[model samples]
Target chain A: TQLLEQSPQFLSIQEGENLTVYCNSSSVFSSLQWYRQEPGEGPVLLVTVVTGGEVKKLKRLTFQFGDARKDSSLHITAAQPGDTGLYLCATVPFNKFYFGSGTKLNVKP
Target chain B: DAGITQSPRHKVTETGTPVTLRCHQTENHRYMYWYRQDPGHGLRLIHYSYGVKDTDKGEVSDGYSVSRSKTEDFLLTLESATSSQTSVYFCAISETGGSYEQYFGPGTRLTVT
Candidate 1:
């Protein structure tokens, strides 16, 4: 079983459209992080939400941590072609970092 | 920007052969990790090191072994390569165990035939 579950395994939308990806789990975590991975490169940290119900905004991207700390969401406003990549949510439980299957986003021009 | 690099960005090895991938970091972070990314599996941990000569097994460490003789270098060795082991391996570093942001290396793509 996957420690984290992400929804909409793949998403393709036209530029300027808005979309949201989700990450959920049955267990509570101290914190959760969101990363974006481009082709042929490693994933890069986008934002980290430590407290429950915390929301962070990074430019056109917004991340929200669930009140129960078992889920999180990433919403993109006015998506652009440059936002095309794999979106992964991660957390550290039991001293090990676990990642979700990831949501592959394709923002078409 | 993480000052981390993986050796032999890409490698192809035959079955039953031993293969070692090296991860070198200039950040001198205390914790280092090795993870393998597959099609449906985002990134599964293989092994991790907390300090020099201090290491522990990850979720998927059955066929892999890690050595961290120094703080700046961590090595992952596959005893006998298997076709199932073909995946892209990534190295990440963090200052602390959890809650801290991790910096990742470019990654090494290994193909076992």
Candidate 2:
């Protein structure tokens, strides 16, 4: 079974602060996906990194897939209160999906 | 923000009771998925359906059952609610072309007391 472990289970920072979350795994994945979810809502996809060492940016958020395809990261620049939520990482395995433990981030204004 | 909608946004049920969660989608996507979220577990897939009448077990499939009678509807049922089953459930749909992007529903918060 493939499992993804996320670092800094909880993070609280003030507005305009920069933060980064890491997702690590022991097994290689064909692809990895990042998602952000608010309270009482399902997660929304942020980005999908397929190739090793691929980097994708979304506005103030940056995502990178490890060159080994076994880890990934999400970095936020100048995070605002609106960025507060639970960020999740998922790996697809032969039609089955596995998710990381998740990082709960709270950006206080 | 996907075209997915789950019924019974909030539910409170006693132990040993049977409860079914409904997921309806308007996108007509071929792949429908059910997931449960807890504090540290993130989102664990409970079950999924690739097409009408086709379903598969996910990471957390115990105490849960799913059915898809049509392409746009996927239902999750808990035969006997347990305290461990108290969590938020989400439904998602992925488009064709083997894309990794999936749209999800708002989610249903189910409490077992």
Candidate 3:
């Protein structure tokens, strides 16, 4: 089974701070997706990285896929209260999919 | 929103009781999935359906069953509810051909006491 391990299970920081979350795996993945879920709601897809060593940015969020396709990272800059949520990483391998444990981020005002 | 909706936003049931959750989508997606979310476990796949009547077990499928009789509706059934089964369930949809992008539903919170 392919497993994705996430670090810093929980994080709390003040507004305007920067933080990075990681997702690592021993198996290569065809694609990786990042999602942010708010309380009482389903997760919203933030980005998808398909190629090894790929990097994508969305506003204050940046996502990077390792060259081995077995790891990924999410960096948030100038965090705000709106950025507080549970961030999840999911990897797709053929017909199977695996999700990381998740990182709960709390951005204080 | 993914045009997906899950019925019974919250349910409380006793152990051994049978329960079924319903998922409906307006996107006509060919792939539908069921997942459970726990405090430390972000989300674990319970089951997934590629097409009508074509379903497969996921990482955590024990004691649970699912069916997709129509393109828009997928149903997840718990043969016997257990305390361990108490968690938030989510339904997701994706197009065929391995786009790998899944759109998620609001979610259902089930409590087995």
Candidate 4:
């Protein structure tokens, strides 16, 4: 079985603070996706990285895929209170996806 | 709001009781999935359907069953509810191809006491 490990299960920082969360696995993945979920709601897809060493940015959020395709990271700059939520990384091998535990972020104002 | 919705947004049941959750989507996607979210476990898939009557087990399929009889509807049932099965259930939909990037529905919070 494939396992994805996520770091910093809990994060709390004041607004404007920058932080990074990581997802790592020993097994290679064809694609990886980032999702953010709020309380009482299902996760929302943020980005998908398919190519190795690929980096994609959305607003203040940046996502990086490792060259080995076994790890990924999400960096947020100038974090705001709106950024508080649970962040999850999912690896897609063929058709199904296996997800990392998750990182919970609290951006306090 | 990916056009997916789960019925009985919140439910409370007792152990050994039978419970069913309903998922409906208007997107008509070919792939549908059911997942459960726990405190530190992220989201674990319980079952997924590739097409009507073409369902398959996921990583965590024990004690649960699912069916997709129509393109727009999928159902998840628990034969005997346990406290361990108490979690938030989410339904996801994706098109047939690509990375199958999924869109999730508002979750159903089930409590087994």
Q: Which candidate number has the best lDDT?
A: 1
Put down candidate 4 lDDT per residue, A27-93, tens digits, no spaces.
8888899999998888989999999999999999999999999999999999999999999999765
- Among incorrect, acceptable, medium and high, the docking class of model 4 is medium
Chain A TM-scores of each predicted structure, in the order given, are 0.98, 0.97, 0.95, 0.96
lDDT of 1 at B47: 97
Q: What is the lDDT of residue B23 in candidate 4?
A: 98
Per-candidate DockQ versus the true complex? 0.87, 0.67, 0.72, 0.72
* Reference A-B contact fraction recovered by candidate 3: 0.69
Evaluate model 4 with DockQ and give the value: 0.72
Q: Put down candidate 4 lDDT per residue, B1-113, tens digits, no spaces.
A: 57999998999999999999999999989999999988888999899999999988888999999988899999999999999999999999998734767999999999999
> Interface RMSD (C-alpha) of each candidate?
0.7, 1.8, 1.5, 1.4
Alpha-carbon runs more than 4 Å astray in model 2: B97-99
Q: What residue runs in model 4 are displaced by over 4 Å at the alpha carbon? A: none
Q: DockQ score for model 3, please?
A: 0.72
> Which stretches in model 3 have alpha-carbon errors above 4 Å?
B97-99
Q: Candidate 3, residues A26-74: lDDT per residue as tens digits?
A: 8888889999999999988899999999999999999999999999999
Residue B112's lDDT in candidate 1: 95
| Local accuracy by lDDT, each model | 0.96, 0.90, 0.92, 0.92
Winner on lDDT (2 vs 3): 3
Candidate 1: give its CA RMSD in angstroms: 0.6
